[model samples]
Structure formats: C-alpha cells, structure tokens
Target: MKKISLILSLIFLSIGLLGCQQSGKEEELNKEISKSTQEITDKPTIIGEIVQIEGERFLVENKTEKLPDGRPDAVWFSTDEMESLKVGLIVSVWTNAIEDSYPQQANAKKIEINEY
Candidate 1:
C-alpha cells in the first residue's frame, strides 16, 4: 500500500508541474493577441526607418504584430529570440509556435543584408 501511495504522489507532482508550464504558455498567447488588437488602435509605425542595417537580421524595439490571421492578436516571430540584432534589413525566420517558448521570438532561418 505504501509503495502504491508513493507512486501516486509522484504522478501528482509531475502533473502539477506540467500544469504550471501550460499556464505560462497561455499567458504568452494572450500577450500575442493583445499586441495585434492594440496594433489596430495603437499602430506600431512600421516606417521602414528601422536602422542598424546589419547582415539580414535586424532588431526592433517597439515591434507589434499579429501572431497569425484568423487566430488572435499578433503573430509571434521565431527570429525575435536573438538578443544581438540590428534594424533595416531582410531575414527569414522559423517559428516554434508552441507553449514552451513564450513571447514568440524568431529563429533567423535566413538573412539578406542591404548593400553598403
């Protein structure tokens, strides 16, 4: 009986941890939605000025976008994850749109820099 109780307790603990992780993911999803709705009202201002102009990958501070059409608010980019990035450039990004990675940063799958 004791052994059975121990096993049950461990299972419960694992389930609780998984629950917490799922909640975090939900929060991130909420943020993405809010950003998109806000964009229509707030307007992120994508003026193309976005400087730094590096090798394809670029950084943006006040970037607000939709997650995906017919879903929620803003779409999250996989490339947005990287810290070191500049502005004024083109790049391809891969997405891991799941519950683990929150705020949805980019992966930078491809990059195309401006001519210097």
Candidate 2:
C-alpha cells in the first residue's frame, strides 16, 4: 500500500510541474498577442514637408526617415483640405491604412498644417 501511494504521489507531482510550465507559456503567449493587437489598432502618423501636389493628393517627404533605395521616406496622402496645403509646408497626417509601395499612399483621416 505504501509503495502504491508513493507511485501515485510522484505521478501527481510530475503533472503539477508540467501544468505550471504550461501556464507560464500561456501567460507569455497572451502578452505577445496583446502587444501585437495594440500595434494593429494604433493609427500611424506621418510628419513631413509637402514636396508635390496633384489635385487633392500630395507627396510628403520625411527627411528623418529613409527608404531602402536611399531616398527620403515619402508618402502620398489624399485629403479634402488640399486648398489649405501647399508644397514646402510641414504637416502631420493621421492615417488608418497605408499601401506598401514606393512613395507609400494613404488617405488622411486628419491633417494639421504647421504654422510655426
């Protein structure tokens, strides 16, 4: 009877240790999932100077950022406030989605022209 009890206790202890390890792995996975979710939900903002304009869309050059081709990172944004925007003006644009292409493109959700 004693031998049987010892065997049962060892089995239970092994299971308990495995459960704790699995719990830790699950916690780590949850943290990673939360981090990625936040990144997906956050809207990206671009701050740069307008370099070109075509109708309601304009190209912005971010001097601080660069593309793999050694050109300054640029984005073309379509906005209804084109009347208030012009080349050489610095602006901040909030966007929901950006297309992956040379001179990335996005529709501006909000635009703020820098006066100073």
Top candidate, metric TM-score: 2
Give the lDDT of residue 67 in candidate 1.
Answer: 43
- Using all chains and alpha carbons, the TM-scores for the candidates as numbered come to 0.35, 0.60
CA displacement after TM-score superposition, residue 63 of candidate 2 (Å): 1.1
lDDT of predicted model 1? 0.44
Give the CA lDDT, 0 to 100, for residue 31 in model 1: 92
Cα RMSDs, all models:
13.1, 7.6
Q: Pick the lDDT winner.
A: 2
lDDT of 1 at 38: 41
Q: Per model, how many backbone clashes are there?
A: 15, 0
For candidate 2, what is the lDDT?
Answer: 0.85
Q: Which residue runs of candidate 2 sit more than 4 Å off their true CA positions?
A: 1-44
TM-score of 1: 0.35
